[model samples]
Structures are given as C-alpha cells and as structure tokens.
Target: MSGGVVTRGRERRDQQNGQNSKTTEQKRDEEQVQLAEANSLALTMRSGLQAISKEIRDLKTEMKKDLTTLKEQVTEDVKSEINDLK
Candidate 1:
C-alpha cells in the first residue's frame, strides 16, 4: 500500500507499528543502495571469472607447448638411437 492502508481490523496494529514502518522515500533510498551494492558485487564477480578464465587459457597454451616440446625431444632421442644402431 502507498502509505499503508488503514483498515478497521488493522487500525490498532497500524497505530502500534506505524512508527516502525519506513516512509516510501526511505524505502526507495534503501532499495537503490541495495541495487547499487548488488551491481558492484556482480561486476566484481564477472571480472574475477574473466581473470580465472584467462589464466586457464594461458595455462592450456603453455601445457600444449610443453607437450609439443617433449614430443620433439623424444623423437630426436629415437632418431639418435637409430643412427647409433646403423
């Protein structure tokens, strides 16, 4: 309700808790603050995820390079053994 609907049944309850209720302006301000905080947290999380994803990609590339190097080294060793046998 806009300011709080006052029904006969709720009259007493309203009277008692009226002071505890927030004004619409106060509620709006609080909601805006909460939204801003949520947006900030979402941005932070997104950036964190991006950083992790980049790290993973870099690691994969490095791993592939290392594996290729190891394979080449093994091939060279095998060729050297064949030459020795001949």
Candidate 2:
C-alpha cells in the first residue's frame, strides 16, 4: 500500500507540472503577440509623424513666400502714393 501511494503521488506531481508548463507556454505566446502589435503601432505612428513634419515644413516655406510678396507689393504701393502727393 505504501508503494502504491508513492506512485500515485508522483503521478499527481507530474500532472501538475505539465499543467504549469502549458500555462507558461500560453502566456509567453500571448506576450509575443502583444509585443508585435505594439511594434507595428509604433512604426505606423512614426511614419505618420514624419509625413506631418514634412507637410508643416512645406507650408512654412509657402507662407514665407506669400508674406514676402505681400510686403513688396505694400512697399511699392506706399511709394507710389508718396510720389502722387508730391
């Protein structure tokens, strides 16, 4: 009877270890999937930020040109008005 009890105990322990190993493997797989998704999201955000930065730079350049043209036109108009007064 003692030998039978020892064998049963060992079987139970082995079953428990197997269950723990399976659970650990499942958790590791889930963590890997989550890490991959996070990496993909980060890459998408980086690309979007880069595109927005380029658009802002282009807009700034265009605005500067428009402002310079307006300033030149205003200066010419003021000069013409002064000449007319003289």
Candidate 3:
C-alpha cells in the first residue's frame, strides 16, 4: 500500500508538471505576439514622423521664398518714396 501511494503521487506530480509546461508555453507565445505588434506600431509611427518632417521642411522653404519676395517689394517701395521726397 505504501509503494502504491508513492507511485500514484509521482504520477500526479508528473501530470501537473506537463500542464504547467503547456501553460508557460502559451504565455510565451502571447508575449511574442504582443512584441511583434509593438514593433509594427513603432515602425508605422516612425514612417509617419518622417513624412511629417518632410512636409514641414517643404513648408519652410515655401515660406522663406514668400518672405524674400515680400521683403524685396517693400524695399523697392521705400526707395521709390525716398526718391519722390528728394
């Protein structure tokens, strides 16, 4: 009877260990999936940021050109007024 009890206990422990191993594997797989999703999101965000940066640069260039033209026009107008005064 003592030997039978010991054997049965060991069998139960082995079964429990197997179940625990399966649970741990599932958790690992879930973590990998989440990691992949996070990586994908990060890549997408980087791409979007790059696009925004390009757009901002283009806008700055256009604004600089407009400012230059306006400055030239103002300078010419001021010169004309000065000539009239003279």
Q: Give the alpha-carbon lDDT of every model.
A: 0.89, 1.00, 0.99
Count of clashing pairs, candidate 1: 0
TM-score, structure 1 vs. true: 0.66
lDDT of 1 by residue, 8-48 (tens): 54887786577556576678889999999999999999999
lDDT string for model 3 (1-86, tens) is 99999999999999999999999999999999999999999999999999999999999999999999999999999999999999
Error of 3 at 57 (Å): 0.7
lDDT score for candidate 1 against the true structure:
0.89
Which pairs of residues collide in candidate 1?
none
Give the per-residue Cα lDDT of candidate 2 at 19.
Answer: 97
RMSD values, in order shown? 7.8, 1.2, 1.5
**Candidate 1 residue runs with Cα over 4 Å from true position:** 1-22
Query: TM-scores of the models, in the given order?
Result: 0.66, 0.89, 0.85
lDDT of 2 by residue, 1-86 (tens): 99999999999999999999999999999999999999999999999999999999999999999999999999999999999999
Q: Clashes in each model (backbone N, CA, C under 3 Å)?
A: 0, 0, 0
